[model samples]
Structures are given as structure tokens and as C-alpha cells.
Target: MLFVEAKWLYNDALTFMNDHDINDYDSKTLTVHVLDKDRQPVTHELRYLSSQMRQSVIQGIKNNMKSLATLRKHDRKTGSLKYKSEYLSINLQQSGVTYKFYDKRHIRIQGFKKGIRIEGTNQFWNIPSLEFANAKLLNLPDGYYIAITTYQTKRSEERKYKPSIGIDMGIKTTITVSDGRKVKVLVEESERLKKCQRLIARRKKGSNNRYKAGKLLRRAYQKLGSKKRDAANKIVHELLEHERLYMQDENISGWHKGLFGRTVQHSVLGLVKAKLMKNERVTVLPKSAPTTKYCPHCGKLKKDITLFDRVYECTCGYREDRDIHAARNMILLSGLSTCGTQEINAFGEDVRHWQNSAVQPR
Candidate 1:
């Protein structure tokens, strides 16, 4: 009931915003007429959704509007927000006020009279000086989940630091680290997923069986997504343990359009790239820097390399595995290239012309 009402209110607010400015839309007096599953119009008050939930919906729309405006300001192609058919998340804007932890594994929401049982609280239960902030209630395919944001003081600890490393992302083997490590992170589709898809396709449209099949399909997708996230987190955590990281800004989207698109997608290359980019210690080289084509030994670009070549052979008698060569080049390029000269220009070359000329022998 809460999620349904939130969706209704969101669509209503979006319609109002289209006709008028967001500030002019009245949240208190606005009433939405909802329809039953049989297409009968029924009127009701905002009983299920709390005041904060309604406010969160409005704030969400406003934030999306601001984001679109920012994109337009930067000359990006923009589009209007479409009405949502389903709403699966609600934001509890305050911790102590809107929600409170009753115990280690139970919580009370604003509208509910009794506490709700929750799992996965054992990790943060016994921690000292823990502070709770805002939380989100998620309606997922498997079950309901509450994600709480908490803050705690950092504990200083003695740490062992490893040498700086570089990584090259590839479709064949997810990542190739500079220290001669090739990690494969491919989560192939399970048999259950394929069976669920087949069942969903066989069911008649608009029937209850079809609805059940659709639920199963969603659950399968959710499981697959969880596997990808777990793999990415583990890989990133291991990589960040080093003092520094060097990686290239790869063209993952272009890989999606190529012949090996499905291979790249299944391997989760994009997710790994995105996670690595967020780290403060990671330095990203330009996409046109030719990490794979440039010979690290002689500093000459080999334009004849193809995807079929697993080994990189240079005219200066330098030979190595293609992916390893690219990973090693990340370190060399990071030292030779300046921070300000990292972005490429329209000619598919670095913006700094002198840096290119300086690298070539006379």
C-alpha cells in the first residue's frame, strides 16, 4: 500500500510539475484519483504514505529536474521525465524522527505501530559509538530490505602497504593487474534463469500465470545482479589495498557495440571500471593513449596490432602478453604524462602536443 500510493503521488506531482512550476505545486491540498485493478476510479486520502514519504517523492522529482538542467547546461541531449508505472523505494529522511532501531534486528517506521523484523544487522550491532542517519526501504523481487546509513569514528590501525599497481580491463579475462595477476569474473546465466525465462514466454499475456512468471524472471535478474556486484566489490577491495593504482579510461560502450558485446556484458567489465574510477588512489589515462599499442620498451606506437593477436611484439625486440603489456604501460604512461594532459582532443590524440613530440626519438 505504501509503495503504490507513493507511485500515485509521484505521477500526480509529475503531472502538476509539467503544467506548473515545482514550487507552485501544492503538496497539502493535492488529491489523486486512483484506479482499481478492474479500471474503476476510487478516491482516497494519503493514508498509507507518511508526510515524509510524500515529501521525499516530491524532492526526488526535483532532484531529477535539477540533474537534467545541469546536463542541459553542459550541452548534453536531455529529455523529460516519464511517469513511473512502479515505485520500489522510499526514503526515510530522518533516523530518530522518521525511523528508529528497536533492537539489533528490529526497527520501527513512522507509520507502523509495531516494530518490523530485519536481517543483516549483526555486522553493525555491537559497534561502539555508532550513529544512524537516513535510510531507504527497498521493495525488491525477493523481499523487502532496509538500508541504513551509519557513521562511526575511524579506528587507526597499523597497515602493510604494497607497491603501486596498474590494471587493464579486458573481455577475455576481466582484469589484468600489473603484478602478473589475471582475474576472471564471469557469472554465467544459471539454469534456473533460463527455465524462468522459458516459462514466462509460454504464459498467456495479462493472465495470473504470466504475472507469476514475471515475478520469477525478476528474481532471477536480481540474483544475477547480486553476483556481479559481489564480484566487483571483492576485486576492487583487493586492488585498492595497494598504495596507488593506474588504469586507462576504457571505451566500454564501444565494446558493447562490437562483435564481442555479449562477452563484455557477461564479464561485467563496465561495473569493474566504474567501481575502480571512484577510488581516490586510481589514476586514469586517456582512452586514446594506446596502452595496448604503445611499446613500453622503445616508446613506439604499433598501429598494426589486431584483436586476434594475444601477444604484443614490438620492433625493438620487446615481446609480452598483450593484456600484460597494456597493464605495464599504464604505469609508464602515468609517470610520463602530466595530470592536466590526460584528456584527448578531437584528433584522437592527447591535448598536449609537446608531450607527444617529446616521447618520439630524433
Candidate 2:
């Protein structure tokens, strides 16, 4: 699949007439909806919005551009960036869209009939998704440009095994699998974000420089988020290839409230939680189940265990790495609970154990 952006089509329409007394750019607002490959809406409110909303929408694009630029600067190796700097690609909130890339010519943005020609002489790195979606519109704030990019999708190889696994997510590490495996994906704190944040913090509240710093910091955060999302996707794909999986009702939010607060605040656990919940083969254990506190074999509760203790050593001679033990317990617990019910919510139906919260549950 190609990475294509829908831009400029509405820019001319948004321009104001010089003779008109009214601000045409502000008055003539339009909203655009995203259509799927089959032209169905994927989002509810993200469809075409007013020009003000569109300007705000461009902030998201600006965020993406800033992030790409930061990644290009810091993630470069051997004098080359990990992600190419030649093309700045983004997905506008518009719905119903699909695209294709060809070797000889320009990128064809779906929905619109004509293809936007490719920009520059940059080479295409062979990636799978290029067949359906190639980078078409290299976008900048001033005007539309052509972009060349790579696309990658899962390979066509057939699966030979039927094993599946469930996970317990945590802040210090990425995930704790039920099979005694701990996948610790590390994220280095963004130095650029820190610098921007510090600069913004030191400036006067409403100054232009302060505003610029805020934008830069926000971009740093956006880049950090993208990196995390890519990592989560790769890990989730690996977990899903298995035949079955058992996952826990984890306390990701509680972790965010405690010490190491900022470090784990915007953790990948949220993305992992989302990915596992959507998978058909994954069976979820109730969030209240004490995967960390309860023993898998003897059903004993180790109330004294602390977060600093990396290993789970119980009085019953049960010894395992803390995350691994929790992961295995997740698989075991998945079989005993209702689809979304956790032990905390296992009380009478009238009690309503689930609190009103915005948690991204697993």
C-alpha cells in the first residue's frame, strides 16, 4: 500500500476573492471524510470540517513533518537516515481512499481520477505495500510536491505452527508473555523534546518563541508516538501468528499514576492493549485478575511482592522472572473469566465494578 495525502484540492477553493469584503477563506468552509478501500467511513467526526478545523488539521500534518525531521536527524546511521528525508507523507483525516504506485509514472491518488506525478530522482526501496499504495503527493505547507516512499506488508509465507500466547503489559518493559517470555522494548527519551520543553518552559507564556517551542515539543512527542506505534505493530504481529493467546486485565493506568510517572506515562502498553483486544485468537483475562499477585499452580497470593523485585519468588517454592510468571498466569486466567470481566468486576452485576474511566482496556 502507498502512503498518499489528499491536499491542495481544497486549497484553491479556500482562497478568498480579493474584491469580496468577507474573508472567503474563513467563510467558505468544507469538510472531508475518509473512505475505505471500498469507500466506507472509518471515522465518525473526522470527516470534512470547516476551514478553521482544517487549519487545526494541518497542525497534525505539521506534527508529522516535525517528527519525520527529528527522526531523520537523530536516527541516521552511516550518513543515511533510517526513514528517508526526501518525502514527507501523511494521511489526511479523509475516509474512502486507496492508491497504487507504478514503476514508469506518477502516483495515482484514489477517488480523484488523475495521478500526481512523482517528485525528484530519488529511488524506490522495494517494499511489499508499494504494489497497492505508493507515495504520491510530497506535501509542504506552501504547495504540493511529489513524494517517493517504501511500503511494507506481511509476507505470503504459510504458517507451520499453531501456538498462541497472551500478554500482560507493563510500563518498565513492553510486555510479559504467558509462556515465560518478557519482551522489553526500549524507548530512549527524546532529547529534542527535552530541549524544546526546557526552552518553552523558560520563555514568557505568550511569546512567539515560546509558541514555536511548544510546537517543536509537540512534534517531538508525535515522533515518539509514531516510533512506539511501529514497535507495537511489529510485536503484535508476532504475537498474533500463534494459534491462541491469553492476556491479562492489566493495571496500566495505575502505573501511570505512580513513580517513574513520566517515563511510563505515554507507554506502548496502550497500543499493545488495543492490538490484543482486536485479535480474534486472543482470549482476554479480566483486568482485576491478580496475575502479578496470584500464584499460577497453588493459587496463593503473594501480597508482599514489590515492583522493584524483577523475579517472582513465592513461599511455595515458585520461582520465575516476575514478568514471565505474570504472562503465564495471564494464559491460565483467561480460561476462568467472562470476556471482559476482571476479578475486580466479578461481583454482582448490579454493583457495576467497572468505574467510569477512559482506560484503553485489554
Candidate 3:
């Protein structure tokens, strides 16, 4: 009922904002406009949406407006907000005022009469110095979820970190580290997911059975998403154990349209890239950088390398694994000319000669 009312309020605000300023819209009103089966407008009153939740709906529009304006300022194409048929999330802006946690397993949200039992609270239950902030109520196919934002003070103790390394993302071997750790990543869809998809496709459209089938399909996809996220999390955590990480900005999505679409789709390369890019310890070289083309040992560009070349062989008598070689260049070739650690040959030319400083691939 809360989410249904939220969708009504959001659509009403979007319609009103098309001609009027958002500031003039009232948030305390439970009355909203809806279209009936005859495509006629009718006044509907909300029963479960509190004033705070109502205000959040309007605030979402304001945030979208700012986002669109920012995109336009950067010369990106933009569009007006569209009306939502179903709202999936609602911001509970104030802790204790809008929502409260009764215990590790129970929580209370505004406009609800009873406290809801939640299962995932044990993940962060007894953390020291943890502070809860604003949370979002999420409506998913499986069930309702409350995503709470929490903060913890910085610990004085520093964690031990390994030596710096570079990474190379690929198709067959999902991730190849400079230290010779090649992680093959692929999570195939489960048999249940395929069955759910087939069931949904055969059901009659607009029927209750179709809706139930659709729900089952969505839940299956959710499970698949969870597996990908867990894999990405583990890989990111392991990579972050190093003191620093260097990687090139490769277009993983572009591969999805190419010959290896199925392979790319099943891999979690996109998720790994996103999570790793967020860390301060990670250094992302520009796409224009010749991470694969540059020869680290001979200090020369090997322009003849192709997709079929699994091993990088240079005429200067240096050879290495293709992905490992590229991974090594990530650490050695990136901006070496500008940094103070650059080495000079006898001819006074810039050369990359710090191979001993990097991790040797086994």
C-alpha cells in the first residue's frame, strides 16, 4: 500500500512539474490524480503515505532535475521525467523519525502498524562505533528490503598490504594479475532460472498466471545477480589486498556486441571494474594508453600484435605471456616518461628498466 501510494504521488508530481515549478507543489496532501480504465482523470486519496514519505517523492523529482541539468551542461542529451507505473524505492530521510531498528532482526518503518522482521541485519549487528543514517525501502520481486546506510570511525590500526600489482581483464581468462594469478570468471544461469524464463514466456499475457510467472522470473534473475555480486566482491577484496593496483580502461560492454557476447554476458567483468575503480589505491590508465602494444623490456612499441597472439614476442629478444605482458606494462609503461622514476638508456632515450621492482609472473 505504501509503494502504491508512492507511485501515485510521484506520477502526480511529474505531471504537475511539466508546467509548474516544483517548489509550488505541496507534499502534505494525500490526494493525488490517477487515470481510470476509461482513460479519464480521477481524484484518488492516499491512505498509507506519511508526510515525510510524500516529501521524499517530490524530492526525488528535484534530484532528477539537478542530474538532468548537470548532464545538459556537459552537452549530453537529456529528457523530461516520465511517469512511473510502479515505484520501487522510497527514501526514509531521518533515522528514528521515519524508520527505526527495534533489534538486529526487527525494524519499524513509517506508515506501518507492526514491526517487520528482517533477516540480513546480522551482517552489521555488533560493529563498534557504527552509526545508522538514512535508509531506503526497496520493493523487489522476492520481498521488501530496507537498505540502511551506516558509518564507522576510522580505525587507528593499519592493515598489512602486499606489493603493488597490475591487472588485465580478458574473455577466456576473466582476470590476469601481473603476479600470474589468472582468475577465470563466469557464472552460468541456474536450471531453475531457465525453467522460470520458459514458464513466463508460455503464460498468457495480462493473466494472473502470467503475473506469477513474471514474479518467478524476476526472482531467478535476482539470484543470478547475487551470485555475480558475490564473485565481484571477493575478487575486488583480493585485489585491494595489494598496496596499489594499476589497470587500463577497457570497454567490457563493447565486447558484448561482438563475437563473444555470451562469454562476456556470463562474466562479472563489469562489476569488478566498477568496484575496483571506486578505490583510491587503484590507478586506471586511459584507454588510449598502449598497455598491450608497448614492450616493457625493449622500450619499443610492438604494433604487429593481434588478437590471436597469446604470447608477446619482441624482436629485441624479450618474450612473455600476452595478458601477463600487458599486465606488466600497466605498472611499468603508464606515464613513466613524466614520473621521476623514469630510466634513461646510454643514448639518453627514455626506457622502462624497472622489471626487478615489479612482481614476476610465475
User: 256-336 in candidate 3: lDDT tens per residue?
Assistant: 887787767879999998988888888877666677777655567778889889999988777788998777677775433
Give the per-residue lDDT of model 2 (tens digit) for 130-207.
Answer: 433333333443346544344467687876654556566765856767665677665666888788778988999878
Q: Candidates' TM-scores?
A: 0.77, 0.53, 0.79
After superposing candidate 2, which stretches have Cα over 4 Å from the reference?
Answer: 1-105, 108-158, 202-215, 297-309, 335-362
lDDT tens string, model 1, 1-362? 88888888887777677679987766664478656568676766777788888889888988999999999999999999987878999999989878898888788998887899888889896789999999998999998898889999898997776888878887574689877789987878889999999999999999999999999999999999999899888888898888778887777788776777666676777787788777777788776767787766655678999988999998878788888878876766666432221232122334233224322111
Scored by lDDT, model 1 comes in at 0.78
- Cα-based lDDT at residue 289, candidate 3: 65
**Evaluation by TM-score, superior candidate among 1 and 3:** 3
Off by more than 4 A, model 3: 13-26, 37-44, 62-78, 204-208, 285-305, 312-320, 334-362
Measured by TM-score, the strongest candidate is 3
Candidate order by TM-score, highest to lowest? 3, 1, 2
lDDT of 3 at 43: 89
- Clash count of each predicted structure: 0, 24, 0
Off by over 4 Å in 1: 8-32, 45-47, 54-84, 154-159, 293-303, 314-318, 336-362
TM-score of 1: 0.77
